[model samples]
Target chain A: MNLALVTSRDTDQAVRVASPLAVRGMTVSYGQTPAIFSVDMTVRAGAMTAVVGPNGAGKSTLLKAALGVIAPLAGSVTVFGQPMAAMRDRIAYVPQRTSVDWDFPVRVIDVVMMGMYRKLGLLGRVRGQHKALAQDCLDRVGMADFAHRQIGQLSGGQQQRVFLARALAQEADIYVLDEPFAGVDAATEKAIIAVLQGLRDAGKTVLAVHHDLATVPDYFDDVVLLNTQVVAAGPVAEAFTEANLQAAYGGRLTTARVDPESVAG
Target chain B: MGAEFVALSLPPILIGVLVAVACALPGNFLLLRGQALIGDAISHVVLPGIVVAFLLTGLVATGPMLLGAAGAAVIAVVAIEAVRRLGKIEAGAAMGVIFTAMFAGGVLLLEQSDTSSVHLDVEHALYGNLESLIWLDATGWGSLLDPVALAGLPVELPRMALALLVIAVFVGLFWRPLALSTFDEGFARGLGIRTAPLGLALVIMSAIAAVAAFDAVGSIIVIAMFICPPAAARMMTNRLGHQVAWSVVFAVLAAVSGYVLAGYGPLWIGAQASVSAAGMIATVSGIILGLAAVAGPHRTRNG
Candidate 1:
């Protein structure tokens, strides 16, 4: 399947039509409680997009629904113009650290290798090639030295890096990461953002569920402001306004100067 | 005198060894999943099931009794899962309620039935009887090749062969899913692995293992057989594949040694050997578990 070129609603209409990821009218619920409501958004290829919202704003739920980890209560999610299941190998997901057991008895290399499990298939052993790819992913994340260490032994930021390494190993066209910066050290956070920026520069779409409002304008070129539903989404300069922030965070967004260093140069 | 001892002691030892192999295989998976106490619960709750099957059939048929036991165990598992899902109770508490109630019902059933007169006793269920396993019949290639050797050896290979077959089938069929699910449920699910069939298969396998041991060592000692070897092996290894391999080796060793002890140890002590082959095998497994606890890495202080 080919990646669909979606119309950019904010930039000049004549700029060019190219969007790699799109979720149309996606709704998700936990039992009777609706977590997300009819959310429509599109992500451009070769662009880093940040999904920013307050807690309980359905940010994590949206990412999970896109990954097909949780079936949407209503609507559909498409990656590169194909359904989620048909494009399982093309999309990589990095769940939040809190979603997994830190004490699981597996090494960092083992965690990274899981990204290759789907490609390997059942009864398909991990050959030398797979191991080499996994190591390369680790090296890219600057975690090659810690590859053999148990995941539980790593700090929170290190754990997040290991997860990113796993996603890198998948070699997918798109990435959906949930809370990639929560509780990580400053260096680890910068390293993660650098890897993400690298992915964006290499013609890949990166969708991150970000919590720190302070870094939105700097880290992401595009922003989707959400509170149960899509309040706004477009170029960072256009969508990230004080009025939209107030709508999403409900007076929690204090007006402050955006950090210059946080943005991609 | 020595010939008689060999004839009487060898079969029980062989049976104990088989029981150890059976329990050790599934015990590793169960322990890794942190559902170790389910073994205890299944053993206790299956008592009523066996008693009821016996009452209906009027004969201690291994097939029907095992089926009944397995059915009861499945019910217990489903009940545990349901309670955990619906009432939000801990798995251990749910298991406790189910097993105690079922075991009490079994005792009541046994006391009220005429099967009690036939020595279908509960004490025998707890301790087991190695002396009762006499040579029933020797058939197969021995009869075809050499009638004399078959008559001379008097080996009961059928039962042991059957037990080994069960172990092989389960390990072969569910090895991958079992390993994955034991380690991480979310990761397994993310990979699109269907866990329900594997979980059901494990419960059934545990029941089959328990039933296989019930004939040789009785129900209560089956717990030791199922739990001890794997626990001991865990102390020695952390890798899932290595743990299973070592557990099998430990189980076979326990069986043979327990049999030998039951047969020969009594001669030296000059006292009635209170410990049956099954009990000895379990005790050996327990000792192995203790050593593993002491020497193995990842030793939990709480344990």
Candidate 2:
């Protein structure tokens, strides 16, 4: 019976290897207030997952801690079945649009080139090819024409797209974004979704902290309904139900409704 | 333009320029990071560092002073972080609480200690002795080729030059990472750049510039140069590279023109004695910043 239990555990580990990002027993706090509690989550490989929660629900905190931007009080994160440190280059992250100061004196191209820093290493010269690659990423995000323009000159949606372009320039296997669609125009929203869908088609893993619940079913294949902890995490059809939404948001979110059958089909 | 220029005016102007460049270079990043007051804080704290160093060594030497100032800068940073974290105070408030206390303590120490034999005093610390750093060994332009004459140059000149070189090299070697981290710390950290250490390194570089420049040009120029030239340069360009380049140009301009105007401006006005070159340098930098704010093309956010 013990041998059977060990074999089942080995099988579970094998299954975890196919997961792009996995977090176990993660907890984080700010000052005296706890932001997130012990939470366990695993995102499927080559799939789009949306992390949805109400305001102050630790959605952004979870992403930040998992990415090591802020130290976690407790937990471990793995990327591609390896420690996040070892697999850092294989993951790209797009911080929230408001996280950085737009008034910073840098052109659109310069911001995009930042994505290539991991590959460039310290003291590595940015070659012409690197510029072209950054430009290509900008083109992918429909921001190619704004290459010479300063970042502050662009609108909010354009800024978000530029950030996405920078993440694209990383060309990593996994893409993590925080609030990618928050304050963007409808056109930019459509364009960004199309690009993200293209990334999915190319078999890249994507996990984003999505606030808009109306588009969750259409935008993602998987959903992690979270408040302070993981309420439910699985395919959008199974995990993004009315019960899960109620459990995660309590009375804060009254309008978000997801049809399990529609999402499933 | 012969002996008078080489002996009296040249060394101060050069030192002034080096100080401006050193402070303004790091000032660019600090200003953009919205931590321009870090420079201001550092200059204010430098007095206490120098006084403490003097108290420790009982000698007014450059090496001991630099170490003491560097040590003080580090302590100030640590204290600020601690207050901000432990007391849950805002960063600006914490900085204000610590720097002002340290600076006041330094002034009190200077007053209480016996330093009548040395050239150390509040006036010298505030305005500096820029006018007195004259090259008496140089007779004329021919002194340029004379090694013995060069050896007689004020020690502050070579020291400031070396400080400027070190700052420039630091800015150059770490330009990419610094800019990236400054622009977006989270993204930079995500790329495994180690943002915290990079930030501390930047503060250390700023402290070095502050300490080195504080000795010759005084705290006034140290504070002004750290904010003005870079703030003006920021108004001139939308690109970081261009902004850095423009800051150097502005630093040089402020140094040379401020020195010249201090000496000759008073003479032209038919006055007997020249005004303080350090004060004039700081004033010139402020004026340049004002000009950029008013007329610079990229001054506004829209641009």
Best-performing candidate as measured by DockQ: 2
Q: Compared with the true structure, what per-residue lDDT tens digits does model 1 show for residues B75-183?
A: 8888888887677777778888888888899899999998855767777666667657754343333332465644554232355558668876877666766666666
* Cand. 2 Cα-lDDT: 0.90
User: With candidate 1 superimposed using the best TM-score fit, by how many Å does residue B133's alpha carbon deviate from the native?
Assistant: 2.9
For model 2, what fraction of the real interface contacts is kept? 0.82
State which docking tier applies to candidate 2: high
Task: Please report the candidate that would top TM-score against the real structure.
Answer: 2
RMSD of each: 5.3, 1.9
Chain B TM-score for all candidates, comma-separated: 0.86, 0.96
Considering summed lDDT, which 10 consecutive residues are worst modelled in model 2 chain B? B84-93
The digit string of per-residue lDDT tens for model 2 on B1-303 reads 889889998999999999999999999998888778888788888888888899999999989988888888999988987897899977778889989999999999988999878999888878888989999999999998999999999999999989889989999999999999999999988888898888888888998888887888888998898899989999999999999999999999999999988888999999999899999998999999999999998988866
Residue B289, candidate 2: alpha-carbon lDDT: 96
Per-residue error at B82 for model 1, in Å? 1.8
TM-scores, all models, native as reference: 0.83, 0.96
